[model samples]
Target: MVRERSSHWNQKCRCLLLGLTVILILGAVVVFAAVILAGRRDPPAELPQWKGRGSTANLEEIILGRCFIYTRIVNPELRKDCLKIWETFKNAFVSKNPCNITEQDYQPLMELAAHPIQCNKTLLWSKTNELAHKYTKVQGNLLTLEDTLLGYMADGLTWCGSPSSSETNYQSCPHWRECANNPVSIYWKMASKTFAEAVCGVVHVMLNGSINHAFGNSSIFGSVEVHHLNPKKVHLMKIWVMHNIGEQPSDSCSGSSIKELKSIIEGKNITFSCEDDHRAVQLIQCVGQPEEPACRVCRTEF
Candidate 1:
C-alpha cells in the first residue's frame, strides 16, 4: 500500500512541472511578438528635398503658393462663418450657364484657393526668416481663418464663375460687373489638383506621386523621393511642371519606368557649385511648364 502511495505522489509532481513549463513558453512567445511590432512603428519626423518636372495629362495647378489666413478660427462661431462662405460660393453659379453651374461644381476656383492665408501674395513666398520658422506646411493647416471669403474660395464646394481652359470664351447676355456672363474661369480638371494639405517653398503634393491618378497618357506613378524617411509615403522632391502647349517634356521623362524617385538618384551624381557652396544634381522627370526649368536640387552620393 505504501508503495502504491509513493507512485501516485511521483505522478502528481511530474504533472506540476509540465504545467509550469507550458506557462513559461507562452510568456516567452508574447514578449518576442511585442518587440517586433514596436520596431515596425512609424517614425515621427519628415525629411526634405526640392521638387521638379511633371505630366501634361493631369490638370494644371491653379493657385500655386500658401494661403495665409490671419485670424482666430478656433471659436465655433468663426468656423460656422467659414463654412457658410464656402457653401454660398460653391453654388455661386449665375444660373444662366447650366453646364457651368451643374457640371463644373466650382472645381476651378476651389483648386485656385487651396493655399494657406497670408495678408498679401509676397508673404506666401520665401519668408524673411522671422516668419519662416513659425510657418510650416505641416502646421499651416492648424492656423485659422480671420475672413470668410478665403474659406469659400478654397472649398471644393464653392464656385468661381465659369472656369474654362479653351481659348474660346463664351459670350453672355447683359454684363453684370465681373459676373457679366462669364466669370474669369479656370478648367478645374484641366488646371491643377488641390491637396488635402498645402506645402511650402514649392508645390510638391501636386505631383504624380501623391495623387496617383493616371494622366492623359496611360502612365501611373507611385512615390516621389524627398528622403528615405518614409518609403510608403510620397516625398515632394520630384515635380512635374506640365506642358500646356507646344513645349515638349524635359528629357528626363523619356524611356523606362520609375516606381519611385530613387531611380533618378541612382544614376551618377551631377556635381556643381553655387554662390558659396558646391552642389550635386541629376534630372528626374519633366512634365513641361511654360518657362520654369525642370531641374532642382536633391541628395547625392559622394
Candidate 2:
C-alpha cells in the first residue's frame, strides 16, 4: 500500500510540473505578442502638409518687386513698364478656369517682357536646376531663362484663377499634374519656347548625368525648348553631361537618351556635340564637396 501511494504521488507531481511548463510558455507568448502590437501601434514620421491651393503668398508684391529689381538693378538699360506687365500678366488667368489657361494667353506678357539674348551665351538645362543656376552665377558668362525678365519675375511663385470670379484664387490652385494646362505650367512653357527661339550661335545645354532619363522627352528643355530652337539662328548645340562628384554617372553622352537628342539635332541640320563632366561645371560641383574623394581628385587634376 505504501509503495502504491508513493507511486501515485510521483505521477501527480509529474503532471503538475507539465501543466506549469505549458502555462509559462503561454504567458511568454502573450508577453511577446503584446510587445509586437505596441511597436505596430506607434505613430509614423510627419510629412509635409498638403496645401490645397499652391499659390504663393503675396503674389503681386513678390512679382512686382522682382520686376523692378530686374529692371533697375539686374538690367538697368532695359526699361520695362512694371505696372503694365503686371496688369497683362494678371489678365491672363484672373477670370478664367485655372485648368483652361493656354500659352497663347500669356503672349502679351511675353511680348512686353521680351529682350535680346546674347549669342552663344544662352545656357539651357534639364534636371540640373540648382547646379545650373550656380554655374550661371559662378561663370558669369552664361544666362538661363530665370536670369531674364519673364523667368525672373515668376521663378518660384504660383498663381491661378477662379472661373466664377474675376480674381486670383489665393485659396486653391490646381497642381501642374492635376491639369493638362495649369496657368503656371503654361507660363513656363511659353517662356521656355520664347527663350529657345531667341537663343543664337553656340547654345549650351547642361544635363544631369546622375539620374535616369536626364534628357527626357517630357521635360521643358526636351519638349518645348528643343522644338522651338531655330536652326537658322543657332550654330552649334553643346551638351554637357554632369554628375555628382562622388557618385557614378547614371547617364552619359553616349546614353540612349542623349543619342536620341543628337539624332533630333542632326535631323534639324544643327551642329551637335557632347562632353562628359565639362571641367568648369565639375569644378563648380566640387566647391560644395571638397572633402569627397572624387572632388579631391578633381581638385588635383584641375
Candidate 3:
C-alpha cells in the first residue's frame, strides 16, 4: 500500500510539471505575437529623402480662399468648387516624384479652374513682375499673369510632393533651375500656355529694357506664351519694352532678339509692333519717384 501511494504521488507530480510547461510555452507565444503586432502598428521612425517634409494645408487654404474671393469679385459666373479644385491640384504632384511632374500633370486642375480671359487685355511679361503688376493694377484694362486665378494662387509660392507621401514640402523645394521640368516651372509654363491660347485681338507683352536678352526665347513669355498664340485669333502683338524713366532702352525693334520675335510673330501671319520706353510705364515711375530728374520730366523718349 505504501509503495502504491508513493507511485501515485510521483505520477501526479509529473502531470503537474507537464501542464506547467505547456502553459509557459503558450504564454511565451502570446507575448511574442503581441510584440510583433505592436511593432507593425507603429509608424516608421525615419523618413526617406523622397518623402515630402511639409504640409500644403496653408497653400491650399490660400488657393481656396483666393478662389472664393476673386471669383466672387472678378467673375461671379465661374462656379467655385474649391474642394474639388484643391484635390485635383494636390493629386497632380502629391505622392509623385517632384522632378517627374510634367506640364500635363496640371491639366485636370487647369481644366477645372478655367476662367475667361478678356480679349485685347491679356498682358504677357518677362523679367518684369512688379512693374507689370503695378501697370495692370492701376490701368484696370490690362491683365497680367497674377491677375488670373491660377496665377494669383501660385504666385511666389514654392511647393512639391513625394512619391511615398501625400504632403507638400513647404520647408524646401526644388530650385527653378534644378531641372528643366521642376514642379513650379512646369506649372507656370502650362498655365502660361493656357493663358496664351485664350488671347484674342491685340496682346501686349511687357519686356524689361534694362535686362539683356529682354525678349529671351527661353522665357515663359517667349517659349510658352509666344508659341500658343494663334494668328487667326490674335490680330496684333504690341511689344511694350519698359525702360528707366529717362534712359536709353537697351533693346528695341532693331535688337536681334526683338527682331527675331517680330519675325516669329509675322511668320505666323500676325502683325507685330514694338514700342520702346512705353509712356504709361514712364508715368508710373514718375508717380513713385516724383523728385528724380527722370521722373520729373517723365518722357517716353530719352
Ranking by lDDT: 2, 3, 1
What TM-score, over all chains together, does every model reach?
A: 0.22, 0.80, 0.84
lDDT of 3 at 296: 64
Q: What local distance difference test score does each model get?
A: 0.30, 0.90, 0.81
lDDT of model 1 at residue 100? 31
Candidate 2 lDDT at 132 equals 96
Q: After TM-score superposition, what is the CA distance of residue 91 in candidate 1 from its true location, in Å?
A: 5.0
Sorting all predicted structures by TM-score, with the top scorer first, yields 3, 2, 1
Q: Candidate 1, residue 123: CA error in Å? A: 20
RMSD of each: 25.3, 21.0, 4.7
Candidate whose lDDT is highest: 2
Model 1 per-residue lDDT tens digits across residues 35-95:
9999999874322111211111111121111121322332222322334333343344433
Q: Name model 3 segments beyond 4 Å from true.
A: 1-27, 33-57, 246-248, 297-302
The candidate maximizing TM-score is 3
RMSD of 1: 25.3
TM-score attained by model 3: 0.84
